[model samples]
Target: MRKNSIKNIRINSEVQKELSNIIRTEVKDPRIHPMTSVVAVEVAPDLKSCKAYISVLGNEKAAEDTLEGLKNAVGYIRRALARSVNLRNTPEITFILDQSIEYGVHMTRLIDDVVGKEEVSDDGMNTEGDEGSC
Candidate 1:
């Protein structure tokens, strides 16, 4: 049952949504940062386990604390999920820090830096060519 079928996709989205809401409204752990967000959710095809990718807007400390908070509240979150969703077996929740967004931003900055340098060199070359012509 490793297929990524339509039903699995739907269940993933539903779990992601419900978890996000539960975290935002129900969970009151101080370690959980206010800027934490559910980036994505991957549910097993058997619906026995789930991995929730979370992103925290602060530094490494915030990310760690948020993850710790989530880990400590896993039982509560699972119960909440069981109550909210109609799944036969509630998936065991695991929170993982997702740095994909931060990595994308860093890559974009590097690309812009390279492009900017190339444009400056091109401009200098054009100026040199014009001077030689004149």
Candidate 2:
């Protein structure tokens, strides 16, 4: 069930912060890129499951390897989480690759290129689409 109560929201917020810290510092997988960061954390109201969104740095191969490494290290992290937090039942953690940041970057570059082309053609310059200017 989704957390509807204020107390549950607070608990989730605290858990997210703690888990973000734990995941950021505790896991030392060589596969993980140095620029990786926790993008989001979602915990069930009952605290049985947690979904972590992580952004990977470098190429696609690096991201895939990092994900595999994170999956393998989940157990160790969960145990550490149980010890660090005062929760009765530690949530099962799952890692997801967060690509929205990369997608946004790609879109931004595309927009910039389009704007640059437009600026270059601003002074009565015509390519294929400008029959009137031609």
Model 1 regions more than 4 Å off: none
Model 1 root-mean-square deviation: 1.5
Off by over 4 Å in 2: 124-134
lDDT of candidate 2 over 18-77, digit per residue (tens):
767776788888887777777877778888998888898678999998889889999988
Cα shift from native, residue 28, model 1 (Å): 1.4
The TM-score obtained by model 1 is: 0.91
Model 1, residue 84: distance off in Å is: 1.7
Residue-level lDDT for 86 in candidate 1:
99
**TM-score of candidate 2 on Cα atoms, chains taken together:** 0.82
Every model: Cα RMSD to truth: 1.5, 4.1
